[model samples]
Target: MRLDKFLKVSRIIKRRALAKEVADQGRILINDRVAKSSTDVRVNDKIEIKFGNKTLIVRVERLMDTTKRDDAELMYSIIEEKYERDFKNE
Candidate 1:
């Protein structure tokens, strides 16, 4: 599956266009490398998404053209989440 479509079908980014936009901005990585919207995704692939100061990493478990809301979570498994804290305000 395409990276953008996988993000949407897995209910990660909510929309395909947004996924593409994020990918274009170089905020999404596949296997530790920057990935484009058309990048191919397969099982066991690691996807990392950068959201401002927070980052989310997930591993693709399976692929499907369509899935129910309840089954979306089964598509990928959250591996790690990290947040960059600003200490200047402290």
Candidate 2:
């Protein structure tokens, strides 16, 4: 799946437009490299999202065309979370 589409379908970013915007802004990384909104994503890949001073890292668990809200959490596993304080240290 496309990174932006995966983010939206999995409810990671709430909206497809927002996901695209963030990805275009270079705040989204795939496998530790910045990725465009149209980047292809696959299972087992690492995704890093930067929001202001917070950074979220997750590993892709599965890819699905359609998913329920309750099942979205199963799509990825949270690998790391860094808050404002943690970002400052990095």
Candidate 3:
């Protein structure tokens, strides 16, 4: 599955357009390397998304064409989530 499509199907980014935009901006990484919107997503692959002040890491567990809301969480497992504190505003 494509990275953008998988992000949407897994409800990671909420929308396909947003996923593509994020990916294009180099905010998405596959296996520690920068990935494009059209990048291929495979099972067991690690995906890291850097958005806002948070960094999310997830492992691709499975892929499907369409998934229900309840099943979306099953597609990927959250590996780690780190929120960077913005001390500049303090």
TM-scores of the candidates are 0.95, 0.92, 0.98
- Badly placed stretches (over 4 Å) of model 2 are 86-90
lDDT of 2 by residue, 1-90 (tens): 999999998889999999999999999999989999999999999999999989999999999998999999999999999987755558
TM-score of structure candidate 1: 0.95
lDDT by residue for model 1 (1-90), tens: 899999999999999999999999999999999999999999999999999899999999999999999999999999999999989888
Q: Considering every candidate listed, which one attains the maximal TM-score?
A: 3
Ranked candidates, highest lDDT first: 3, 1, 2
Clashing pairs in 3: none
Off by over 4 Å in 3: none
TM-score of predicted model 2? 0.92
lDDT of 1 at 26: 95
lDDT of 3 by residue, 1-90 (tens): 999999999999999999999999999999999999999999999999999999999999999999999999999999999999999999
Worst 10 contiguous positions by lDDT, candidate 1: 81-90
Pairs that collide, model 1: none
lDDT of each: 0.97, 0.94, 0.98
